[model samples]
Target: MPDLSHPAAHRPGHGDPDWAAMRRILVVRPDNVGDVLMTGPVFRALRAAAPRAALDLLASPAGAAAASLLPQVDGVVTASVSWQQLDLVPGSDPDAELVGDLAARGYDAAIVLTSFSQSPWPAAEVARRAGVPVRVGLSKEFGGGLLTHWVPSPPDEEHQVDRMLGLLAAVGVPSRGIALEVRVPDDAATPLAVVGERYAVVAPGASCPSRRWPAERFAAVVRALAGDGLTVVVSGTERESDLVHAVAGDVGVPLAGGLGLADLASLLAGAEVVVANNSGGVHLADAVGAPVVELFAGTETVDQYRPRTTRAEVLTRPVSCAPCRQLVCPFGQECLAISPDEVVAAARRLRAVHV
Candidate 1:
């Protein structure tokens, strides 16, 4: 077989750093909401290792929303980069301006975080251009002198949270704990009070097509939950109003497009059980300690991004085409062919445990 190792152009020996001595540090995870949420433990570890150093995050527009909830993050710099191909949030800074902004912050060190499939070189380039002396990232590809420390990417099955923690370990910063976390603002409020105090949230939307189950199936689950004497609410972004409405129907309340990240966390925190696809909402719910029933899709392995929350259940079927990592499925989405009954059962089990 051809060498699968996309070795870096130059593999320098690890440049050990005394994290505590650093004055300011930047952690880069310019991905989506879910990706940033999974980096929670990495932030906690860095905070512990360099408690006196100011810790900031470089995030995409969506990622920035999740970053705000991370108590360990001191500041957030939002950017939509060309390499990531993320659509710019209106009024957000362009990637071209990133170097200048980062340079102004005078970060002592920068750590670029990416998933197994994503290369960290692009973000590392920005850090390098900004004159950050100690830049660290993981890469199996040619580095092109972008990173000062290039840690090897971990196995595909390693959980995202663990993979991030492992990167910190390579840089001599040990993890504080492997748990997802977010802080709901004390004053944050949700519209769910109208739906009654006891309610389940059914978030039927995912960032991509393949990861989402059919809306009608979600509606069936909503109806079943309502029959169980629990109020049901459907949640989503404003763009997903129609889907949320469809899933909620007459049996459930539709609370789409109204809440911000903090308010959404409040909504999730108050839920008896949250049912969602493999998306950011699930990660958000996990962070807020909500019971979750994850209707997982086969686009990625369950173990790779599984919820670390205690009262959670993942519902997915084995399919040969799983782990394809396709944004849109060309074949049957059999992996997410979970029945509504199965989802209802899992939700009920989580609710029972919570009680």
Candidate 2:
């Protein structure tokens, strides 16, 4: 029942800024590629409502790649802010460097986007320190005056796409719809040479261990898809080469490593169907309008992460500890114990509907 009521209903001070007058805007989404892709609608709305303004993205390294595919984004500034999980330390004072870079960009306004588990205040503070006067963010906790326009966070059960659109609506920027979009840059040629003209993609890797489906199960799905007269390709990051290999087996082509974001977008865009775990691949496939069959884990609410596209089907089992939000599942990942048969069926069902 919790909803993103209105910013006016919760905002402490200052009226809505003149979005039209703003020349440069900074959108902060310092998260994974999936999270950035999920915010595509926000970027879309901003671009439509303020077409004259330059929309820039402040993102992590992984997120920067996704931002580049968004036509709405005029520029992308990559950094690992203090609030984010630091995989590798870039410099001694990365935070200061980020603030300085943002200040130099002369962003007239800033919009901070975050998942339910993350706090927007940290990113909002970066905007404030960078002299971005018009800062907007959604927060369940007090922002301590960091945000110029603060909208209350929506409920946990709210779909992430809807939640972000609601945040924009609260600040006078209406949604252009919840469709996720990614463009294949001219440089990233379609990778159809690696696989047949008609192929299915099996992306079997996730950043979190809890969110991954069993490699053997993915291998089973690959075999099933191959039997259905579709060429199967298993895709993953360079680090996940072993996992991708295990899932590909003999039936599927292993396309681990060395794929840029735009290239991956092109590959998924050409897929007949994409089967993936709850990872960036799911979002990428959805963004490219590829039908997806997702083996979703219970670490997060299914409603929160499920693809917005009706062309997708998500499979999950109920568990008491679901929505645990754990990087590592203490429970044996019982929530993701879906069989390959169900996944194969879902894939066929989606393809039938679309075809």
Candidate 3:
């Protein structure tokens, strides 16, 4: 139960002369959907700090999809380079063209948000090439030479959401009491009729294999919930049909590949609860105000990225090597081997609390 508020423990002085003159601002957060969703509070904070200033975002395709649902953003610019792919080709300069494109817009200032391990150099380089007047980011990689303002990276154990907000505070933005948000378009509300009301959503797929609880475990949870006379619907992208089908093999209705992001949001909005892995769906469920039961398999710290809502229940098994944060588990994934009955019990507890 770590505190997510008060991101900046050591507030820096706003002594920069140009801080007041900056008008148009750009935020670069080319990460995953969850990462982008977590930044919504920061985006809203930026809008509140500069009510009249135009704010733009540079994100990846997935990040852009999530950003489009945020109300504070004036526009989202899709970055051609993926962070994972960029790491593969360290010196390719694929972002060079994007820098030129952003330069043409003539942003007055920019802030780049990144984790402790990731250097903000790429975004800093783009800001420099774009000729943005004031560039702000966390001080790492000894690359402060490229930034106009620098904030120290938060301690390693700090929640990532707080860490991003720490960078925002470095540039005179307030970072307290903000909540995550997402906008579901009116048109996106149509397909949710298929789920009906009083249903639960089961998101059985995760981007990382180590993060996925066993498909059979999901099936058991679904079966138990269905047996309790609740309507259960499973949802995932088209690519995850196989995994979703495997999870729904023995219980409930298989709604796999049945909804897009917006449709999924609409459906989730109507659900009593959402049972999912520590994946994008966890954030989506939180966005729509659905109580979520998020299963964390020790791939990452539960406190760092757990859904930022009181309605959510995070379950993790304490293994000796838990929270290794590895892409692939060297040994069998014991962290996620908790019995299906245990997950169902947790889900039931969450449901009772919400009730």
Candidate 4:
């Protein structure tokens, strides 16, 4: 696919210098919230290496909110480019103004983060046009002379958090840690007081339908968990209210729209165990140090995208058509054919790990 209407015209390769020499750094991850959250370790390494330098993020609207939760970030600039977002309308060159604006800032170096499925060259072009001295990211095809530091991000990935940390390794800055992190705002209130103390939070929403398990199966898990004497809380964005309501039923507390992203995180932080689809909730729970049982949809390989936290378990039924990564499943969704009993058992295993 063509990338953001910008050709790889800029020449690549630059001499590496100590982290102390770079003044202002711009990090770009133009995707959803979970993708941005995965980059937290990269931002932390950059901050620890150059404490005096300003660190800025160029993110989509969804990514900027998640990026803000990382304390290491100094500023956020939201721009939805053609390559990163599926819904947005694009111009002749959607990145022209952004490139000019970024250039005016005189950032010393720019690091563009892209998924294995996406190309970093689009963002790299923006950095090059902005006159950034050094640019970095992974390359599958030839670099097209658009990157200064080329980091290797495998097509079928490893843990996303560690993969992001690998980008820092390209710059000679040692990675601090591989743990995924999110700074839940102190002002986050308890939106669902009914959840009380020890409860299992069930997040049923995934960004794409293919990544989500069947709603009926999730409801069954909630009922089974409740039967085990554990209180259940169902969480989702407003868009998934119907799905949340159906899953919550009369037994679980539906915390849809009642909680902001930070508030939802607080709820997850307090949970004894988080039962959710393989989505942002998994990452959020991991960030808050809560164990999670992921109802994974095997639309893609689990090896690369599974929960990055220590205490987590994934439940998926393998199929030949899996790892197709289709938004709309053409093969009857064999990945989510797992039973409710299996999910409850997976949750039990993850809980045992924490105990």
Q: What lDDT is obtained when candidate 3 is compared to the true structure?
A: 0.77
Clash pairs (backbone) in predicted model 1: none
TM accuracy, model 2: 0.94
Which has the higher TM-score value, candidate number 1 or candidate number 3? 1
Full ranking by TM-score: 2, 1, 4, 3
Question: lDDT by residue for model 3 over 1-355, one digit each (tens)?
Answer: 5654333423455344244455788888888888888888887888777777788888887778788777788888897664447255666777777878888888988888886677777678778877987778875346645676766667766777788887777667778554677888888853445555567889988888888888888998888888876788878778888887887775666776756677777888777778999898898888888889888888777777877754887888888996687888888888887787877887788788766
Q: Estimate, for each residue in 1-355, the C-alpha lDDT of model 1 and write its tens digit.
A: 4555456622556567889899899999888899988888988998889989999998888889898899898999988776877565678545658899999999999998887888888788888889999998877778667888787777768888888888889889988898899877888878755878899999999988999999999999999999999899899999999999999999999988878989989999989999999999999999999999999999888998888865789999998887888989998798887899999989988999886
Off by over 4 Å in 3: 1-21, 86-92, 190-193
Clashing pairs in 2: none
How close is every model to the real structure, measured as TM-score?
A: 0.93, 0.94, 0.90, 0.91
Stretches off by above 4 angstroms in model 4 are 1-13, 85-91, 152-155, 352-355
Query: After aligning candidate 4 to the native by TM-score, how far in Å is the CA of 203 from where it should be?
Result: 0.8
Please report, in order, the local distance difference test score of every candidate based on alpha carbons.
0.87, 0.87, 0.77, 0.80
* Pairs of colliding residues, candidate 3: none
Over 1-355, each residue of candidate 4 has an lDDT whose tens digit, in order, gives: 3343223322344545467877899988877877777888898899888787899999888877787688799888888776765565545777788988898888998888876677888788888888997888876666676777766554445666666777677667789887888888889886546877768899989988888888898899999888877789998888889999999998988877767778878888888789887777788787888998887787767887777655888888988887787887777778888888988998877666665
Clashes of 2: 0
Worst 10 residues of 3 by lDDT: 3-12
**Candidate 4 lDDT for residue 277:** 79
Number of clashing pairs per prediction, in order: 0, 0, 0, 0
Cα-based RMSD of candidate 2:
2.6
